[model samples]
Target: MTTLDLDFVRSHFSAFNEPSLAGWSFFENAGGSYACNQVIDRLTNYYRKTKLQPFHPFPASEQAGREMDAAINNLAAYLNVDEDEIDLGPSTSQNTYVLAQAFLSIMQAGDEVIVTNQDHEANSGAWRRLTDRGIIVREWRVDPETGYLDIAKLDKLLNDKTRLVTFPHCSNIMAHVNPVAEISAKAHAVGAKVVVDGVSYAGHGFPDVDALGADVYLFSLYKTYGPHQGLMVVRKDTREALGSQGHFFNEGLVHKRLVPAGPDHAQVAASSGVTEYFDAVHAHHFGPQADASKRGPDIHDLFQAHEQVLMAPLLEYIRSRNDVRLLGPENPEERAPTISMITNRDGRSVAEDLSKHGIMAAGGHFYSHRLFQGLNLDPEAGALRVSFVHYTSPADIQKLLKAMDAVL
Candidate 1:
């Protein structure tokens, strides 16, 4: 069986070599990943040479536009979606806010949008605000004890008036991977649009949005080892149905329809670096394939295989502790490598304590505060989240475990 080359992977990120980051084992990757060298180089180059308005007639502008176009082209290919379906904006929160307006244009007063307690506030808050416009918002609550969202509950919520069904691909705190394809199918059958917040899951492995059948799939690139931007896949039909949330003249433009916030050209251009990193990884593990959709799934599998290897022992060690309660699945294969534990002490305090031992992690609501309430826990108490990605090494995990033991 092939295993991820950790040394080879870590070399692609310059953060590993930084004197400031030396001796610190990062475990708060769900918050944001350290940008890869590919992305950094692209950003620096863009700022130095082509830091001008894009899509214009001038050379620098043309080059800037080309980089942005290549970014969309490359990323869309990797996500298994068409170029026009991709929308790059400031952040996932802003992107979804604009998208809710699109939905508002299409939705009637009595239409219902299903949300989940497990989603980050970025995905939850905007849609919930639709209540002010008379749109019915339904919540798919998680189990108070386990923080698990049952699909059976969602089945009852799906009906003719269900205009949209919004949920997370995986919770930031819980780390469980929701069945996006299955949920999409159910929503589609009811003539409802599926909006998946893939913010947590995309960091682990970008999904096949085309196959997943989500009308709007949202995730933060910053969390996925790229620039600080939100990437979304808005299906053609959904875009047309909701119409333009941008200027009236831009209604005909596929990319501009929902992106009223416009785009940061440099960051958008840097996105290609993420795809390039994935390409390099794919070619290293398995010979190069021309089709990026093929590369998308292949790279996804490679990432997951490596993550499961890292997650197994960490999960076991957490579950063994009687004092702390682990959220989400008990098995490594069933969830992303984000482990959130509710201990007797405040999670933030635990994180602060871990930091003293050179373990970089976080504790707090993590913008998923609603989840704490749903799980019958106090939001102020928060949950200790120790997350990692492909770039993390076994040595880092060992350091985290030792620090965590000392802190807790």
Candidate 2:
């Protein structure tokens, strides 16, 4: 099993040394990961040097544009998709909204869309709006007790009318990792497109979008230890069907088609930092054998193995606690490192108590209202979410457990 180098990770993050926040063990990585110092340094240097508008006629602007393009291409390669298939947006929420609008032109009245109650509002609300246009919205509900989506029930929900199916690759609230390959195959068998909300899964490891058979996959860069931006991959064939939401002049620009909003140049430039951090982690653990040049399945597997080892103890501990009700699978194999749980008391109170003890954690619906509702959790009460990334240490988990003992 691969063990995380805590000393090496701590050195990479300056936040660990802050005296006032000495006890603060951040466990809210599912919402947003702490930016790596290497990533921050690159962004700071870029800001100091150029900070000019990209894609212009000037040499400096052209170079800046090339850097941004390289970032997009790198991310696309990681996702196992062509360069033209990728699009960068301000946030996952914005990307979904834009995708919904793009589908509006192609979807006729009475066409159906399949959505899961286990998704974040970003995935649900955008597609749900189709109800206004006489488009049928079918909800695949999760089992209240297990918080698992009933794929067999989904078999009943799909039909010829189904044009698109939206679900989370891994839910933020339930912390359930859906079987994307299985579900995608089912959706494809019926001629429906699969759209996966990958924000939660992406932090644990990069996924192969093509292998998952998702027509479109969306994730937030902020949650993956990079800049606050959204990364979206739409299959080239699907991109051809969706009409441009941008200006009339840019209709042929496939990347800008679904995104009505223009790109954030600096954030786009900074996104390469995520790949940089991943490369560093791979090299640290596996030595120079880490091939940063490779993408897709191989790199994703390497990262996933690293994360699984780091998260094992936390999952085992949560399973042993009768006082805690875990939202998803008790088994680590069925989920990501995001541990969502409900205690005997209000989750927010538990979070505050943890904070007082110098543990950085959070409690709330995490914008996954539908999921909380499906699980019969009060949106206001929420659930305590303790998530970890590749850089998270075993010591951090122990610190969180120690805090939990005092709070619970």
Estimated TM-score per prediction?
A: 0.98, 0.94
Stretches of candidate 2 above 4 Å error? Answer: 1-3, 17-20, 287-299
Residue pairs whose backbone atoms clash in candidate 1: none
Please provide, for model 2 over 1-408, each residue's C-alpha lDDT reduced to its tens digit, 9 standing for 90 to 100: 555566776677666776876757788888898887766876786687658988899987887888789888877766767889999999999999999988888799999999988888999999999899889999999988888898899999999999999999988876778899999999999999999999999987788787889999999999887888999999988899887899999998777787777888888888887777666766776666533445334456655666677678777888888999888876667778888888887777888899987777888888888877887779888888888776677677788878888888
The top-ranked prediction according to TM-score is 1
TM-score between model 1 and native: 0.98
lDDT of each: 0.91, 0.83
Off by over 4 Å in 1: none
TM-score of 2: 0.94
